[model samples]
Target: MSSDNPTPTPGGPTRRPSLDETGELPRFLDSATSDEPIGNVKPEGDLAGRRFPLTTGFSALVRNRHALSTLIRRDLAVKYQATVMGYFWSLLEPLGMAFIYFFVFGIVMGANDKDVVPGSDASFVLYIVSGVFVWQWFSAAVTQAANSLGGQSALITVMKVPREVFPISVVFARFAEYLAGFPIIIIIAATFGHGVFGWNLLWILPAILLQAMTLVGIGFMLAAGNVLVRDIQRFLPLVMRMLFYGSAILFTMDRVSDSGLGQKLPWVTYLYEHNPLVVLFQMHRAVWIPGLAPDQVGIMSATFFAVIMMFLGRWVFYKLEPRVLKAL
Candidate 1:
């Protein structure tokens, strides 16, 4: 008869085979007893050999939707922890930014909506507040997502969840903040006498979807790249500063076009209009200032850019995942 336990040697005590000797269990399962460090152990079984498709990030998020939600909640809680105002900070930051910009451009500089925005009766305050609100979400998401992987290296190493969840959670958490601030934007628009109700409001949905898609794609690339090259984390702030001025957040594309530089170099306006954020900000402003909306060609081009970035980001992430794991 055979025994379930290891058999005793003739002269020595019984001993079970180590995972390395047996080669029956996956290497990852042997981490507890293995002499090698956990971080150095390469994954085995499905994790090691599985082939991921281009939709892997999307599919992973969907399959682990519950985990993703829990992560988002955890992030939100951690972010506002020890704070008295908590969630209101999300609304306050962008609102405060709007106030400063309104003071500078609307009052100090005397920027008129009729001339700067053109065809929009909305005041300069509403125009800038609307842009700032959405831009806050984009900026926060990108900055947080870029560091998500490295920041939670220990959790990521231990958790069996999808790696993409880390960056995606940051994106959604900022998105939650974005949604929370929408009411403030509405109140400002209504107070400024900009009509908030109309079929044009439907444009907000696509604008949001496009921005989310773009952010997720950028998040994937930045998250992975930051792990490999630590300089990304250091250098990102400067890039964001440039993007803030270039993205039409504080000024309209029309304002740029009417400027002396734009008039002297017409291609400058063309390049500025082609910026994805320009189109996205215009779409967002379109909710109240319909004339600020991008044309069909601009909309299509932005959509194409979003789609391409998403695919490319996922591919880069997975392709470099092994190296990222080793680095972590």
Candidate 2:
């Protein structure tokens, strides 16, 4: 007459006991395993109590920063090794791009007359350099981030570190390179007779940090997406190209906003204003401009979005990471 049930209370009906209940409180004449608790058996020294694997993603990032930095240095060094130009290419890349763009748009195409251009009083060189300067850093970071997971496919498949680290590290690595190249832009600006630079202009620091956050967020999302759908590699380039046009790459934000074109697409106006890269440009112009320092409103907004995106990105990455590894 015994059943797989807990001993009834003195005045209560029979109830089933939890798996943890003692054998005396539960029994079944026919259920052979009923005496056993159903659960994972513990391994000795389970130093950290077993817990959600998701938190492990962030914990790994914090614990493995040294490993992360080594990966970043390895990536950058791979690009520089055996090249005669070595690190010179980092500073030269944006300079070469600006030169080509200037010759094509400002000199040959007469874009200087373009009202959408800012700093018309300044040399066309300065105006073009500024936009190129802004666009290149972000572009480089995005490109690096997009390919980050794919590049580390081996490390991910072979090792147990957080996969999100690869993409975020790529963004961080490119940001470092961007920072190193920043002096090149300022020196060129000063040499061109367009800027009155000072240490006070260093307000650009927070703006740069905010931009890196946006990159990390978008990079994490894209990297996670790319893990399963390989064609994203193709789609991302097109998206980035469109971003350059939508952002202030070849024009001034004020000119683009005031051109009455944004009126046609009110939603587009909001998106442009809200995008991280666009915010950075506004902040960049404020600091890089001759007399401007930085906009408090712009800095606050950029920092806020940066934080939101970083958290959101890490959340998304952690949530998707388990499935993402399966694909790899």
Q: Estimate each model's TM-score.
A: 0.83, 0.73
Best-performing candidate as measured by TM-score:
1
The regions of model 2 sitting more than 4 angstroms off are: 1-59, 113-121, 257-275, 290-301
Lowest lDDT 10-residue stretch of candidate 2: 23-32
lDDT for each candidate structure? 0.79, 0.65
Model 1 agreement with the true structure over 297-322: per-residue lDDT tens digits = 78988899889888888888888877
The candidate scoring highest on lDDT is: 1
